[model samples]
Target: MTSRRDLLATLGTVSLAGFAGCSALPFGDGQDEKSDDVALPAATVEPISWPESPFPVAVPSTLAETHRDRARELLTAVPVDPAVPNSAVAEELQSDRERAADRLETDTQEPWPTQELSRWRDRRHAAATVRGTYRAATGEDDAEAVTERRRAVRDELSAFVSAHEYRASSPLEAVLVHAPIEELVSDCRRRTRPGSGYPADPVADPFQAGDAVGLVEFADATLADARGLRDAYLADRSNTSAQWVPLSDTSEQLQIALAHTRSTVQDFLEHDEPPFDADLDGTAGRWLFTEASRRVETMAEEHDVYRDDGDYARAILVAGRTLAAIEALRTTIDGINGDAYRDEVTVESVTRTAERAREALAAIDASESPELAAQLCRPALDTVELLPEVIEEGYADAGRVQGELAWAELYARAVPAATAFVSERLG
Candidate 1:
């Protein structure tokens, strides 16, 4: 295992090599001018050599078994919004097509895949085709037609893969381990798209990657470099030049607060989450939800955050994901109130986090959020910074780090504060 110092030194080398060797990664999205890793040369990103015809030519592994009929289940499950006029559906779809056109027009402006990834290039084109088909399809497509359409799409992609002669990578499994952590989570949350690499699929590997779907394909060397970068980020929070990860939340803060209350009222539930009665109802539903939540919490708490020279870089990546969810709260709140009626600390904290989150989201290819998320996580991230020293120094250190601790405690308070603020204003 490389020591912390050794890892950082190695990362410095890999970053230099990556920039000198290929297109820059799609991170930060020009948000941080200081990130030297995102820039690339003008030789044009050429397609890499592909592998022999034995490529996995079926549906995605997880989707293969169920997709023949189950592929459209997600779309089928969506209930038409009764409030939306049937007359307007076509117009809305037209607008969507126009937006997609706009996206393609700007795709070149976004970060091109830095690695020699044939799939990335191939997937982009396929995604366009699928988007076009879906947009053009009338709701009248019969079940048989839908199934055939799904098969045709799969065949087209499989043909694309088979034609390529892969060299450096196995086209079957692509696991991205690098890129900013917030960006990672954003990629995971992206709705499954035809060419989006089955990002919502569970990563089959052993890396404790959380809701991070198998999107963003990082080269082996790049992940190695990321390990060092994450470690450096954990320790170097106070540096003025440091690039604090920008995580963006597009969730509406008022809506989030309102939704929680509405849910409670509708259910006549007192708790934000109804205490699961596992004994009374042996359903695995809550168990699964609890496990998922536990996975996220454990990732944050057990991450190498508290080490004096902590070094579990992958876990920290997961921690970044947890932070993104927390930060999303604040991002949704941004611009709605413009810090109105919010304290300086709370405003400043979320504002700072929102900026970082947005930058991260854009870098990771998020098409903005549905609503802004909570912005009260900055103080917690900062407080978490001191947790290591407190553990090491015990009671003496606790007093010295009281400010950070207090801020962490108050970080949770943002929930109630925001709820009250929105409820009061709405009332």
Candidate 2:
């Protein structure tokens, strides 16, 4: 089982790279709506156009494969490295030809433009969706400009999804642009003050956006083949699935579920069956792309939930470390006082947890929001320093834990708070 300490010890240390570091260079972590989540490749990480090579086993595209050609063209114009264009910016893509060439490079650079560009593109796509919904609601052809723009946005969305698919991860983490109907059948309303940090006029509505985005039940299968291949590779490398993924509690459960999910996908793919059929009709194209985008968002959320779930589990495991320290401190203090009450006390257990806890605290990005850290994280750390003094003085008994009662109470609160904070962010 990977305990909290063990996980931290190995994070960001994996020799993760694509095809000898040249084919698909490490790029952006993922850029979606909220958070600086990485999306596709960013500057310093370029996608590699794989050289034609025969595989021992044929690699046949499946599921979204029918629309794969357009998706592949997303990076058509992306060169090995893009030259600084004449102007630092170009208002919009010059043409389809120019767009294909510069799309990938443009997304990977300029103060990290992927998220902004994606949001812009999604907003443009939304314009079409809104119009489509409006026309569906009330037959209106007077909006010819809307129809033309809608088609334009539909094409743009197809390109966006193609770029997104190009960046899909092994577990099939989808790079979603925005939520389903929220981004699609959204109201034609804007903020009175765009950046004033106030609520928008419409507020937040849910039912207004039902399964406005479809093709959802197909997610598991879509990600299955990709995930199965990854799992099979890992198992092959280690010669056993157990060794490749040796986690405990929920972590282990999720891993096992992944194996099952991928295997099911593999079975379906091998049988030449798509996990789910998307409505590919011209009328359904807009909805199909919207679902594609929606899946990306859904995948991003699921990935985050899975990751945070592990962190939460890890925190629970580490709380054991805290308890172990408390027990050790209690025993040592019992010996120190010689069966008599001591106002203050000291022990090695306090020091060990305190020192290690600092490392754990640091992992949570302590510098992020100094004020919040000041209130929540600082107190526990401050208590660490006081432990030795209290122990030496044999201060007020902290019951079974020993030393100061405040020390135990402080840590108990702080540790869980940190755990909750990690989960909140994940949600």
Candidate 3:
């Protein structure tokens, strides 16, 4: 287990003499240091304040009540069962996932215009031939007219290709556009439209509107569910108790669940799979519920730290440093295998570290004693020091990491000074 003190001590050691040039000793030549002769600098430190709590103080207050009401509404709207194989929501969720997957595969398989330009060329040739036949039959061919007709054909083809390219380039945008089309098609096919049978204004019916409304409602409800889960996890401190698992032990599980949820939602919106009833109660719904619950719980716990009368600023600074160190390490790792290792660590790891850093920072109270400041600053410093090793490992194969040589040099220079600052302030 990595203790706070250990992390800090490592930081202090790395920063004091390794990175920062400043020494732990007093400045100037060695002389009889007279306390009376020495004049301390005036205090320039400003008061630091904590941020407002995201959750309300009163459990039964408007905020809580509203959330509760929303939760109840969601539960009523979409009944879920963890053990059951399929529910309405699960079916919907699965259908969405399949659709998304189909879209993704289609997008991937669809070659760039440049790769399929020959097809367009053939079409243009055919059009030109038709124009030629018309001109020959009429015996009224004008060079300018022929050029203009060809230009128009080319322009239209170019625009069509460009649109496909744009959609192919951006998965998110493609999904957004595809979602409405899927919804429209689904609504039209369904018999849930208002009126006993299709009549006047058949195109614009309650079912279509209801599908749109349902999509929006589902999005809002999902966010609310996530928030609720996060809050619950944070409030429950007992790690070993049933129904309240320790966050540390369950982080990986939660991450996987979240990823699955995100994937399911993406798939549903993209309409990759055939419409199925199991989607709503499937992986997407369960994952969303689980992940959201965990985040809310974690965030709630973090909120409490801000309320504590601690050195919040320093804590934040420490967290920033920790993140910086982690980034540096990542950079170092990237340098190791060159571009081959790029995106290897996964964005999720970085995001998780950042979240933890934010929580740790919130727990810090900058108004604490110098000793506490040292303790708080230590972890960040140590993490920073490890950057070089990470970089070195990254570059070990190539003998040197590229694009980060300057950063390595800078870290080497700054570590000592930073270390000295912590030591002087703390000791």
| TM-score (all chains, Cα) for each model | 0.23, 0.19, 0.17
Report the lDDT tens digits of candidate 1 across residue range 1-427: 1121222232442342132211111122232222222222211111112111111121122222222122233223322321223445435434433432333233221111222122222223222323323322332223333334434544543443243221112111101112232232222223223443221211221111211111221111122222332333333333322111211111132224433433332321223342443221122122122222332344345433322222222233333334432333233223112422122222233334333323332232211211111221322332333233223322111111222222233233333333234223222
Please tell me which predicted candidate would have the highest TM-score against the true structure.
Answer: 1
Cα RMSD (angstroms) for every candidate in the order listed? 23.7, 23.5, 29.4
* Residue 37, model 3: Cα distance from true site in angstroms: 72
**Comparing 2 and 3 on TM-score, the stronger one:** 2
Candidate 3 per-residue lDDT, tens place, 212-312, comes to 33333232322332233233333542332221122112222323332343343333233333223332221212222222222223322432342242312
**Once all C-alphas are superposed, what RMSD does model 1 give against the true structure?**
23.7
Per-candidate clashes come to 27, 20, 58
Write the candidate numbers in order of decreasing TM-score: 1, 2, 3
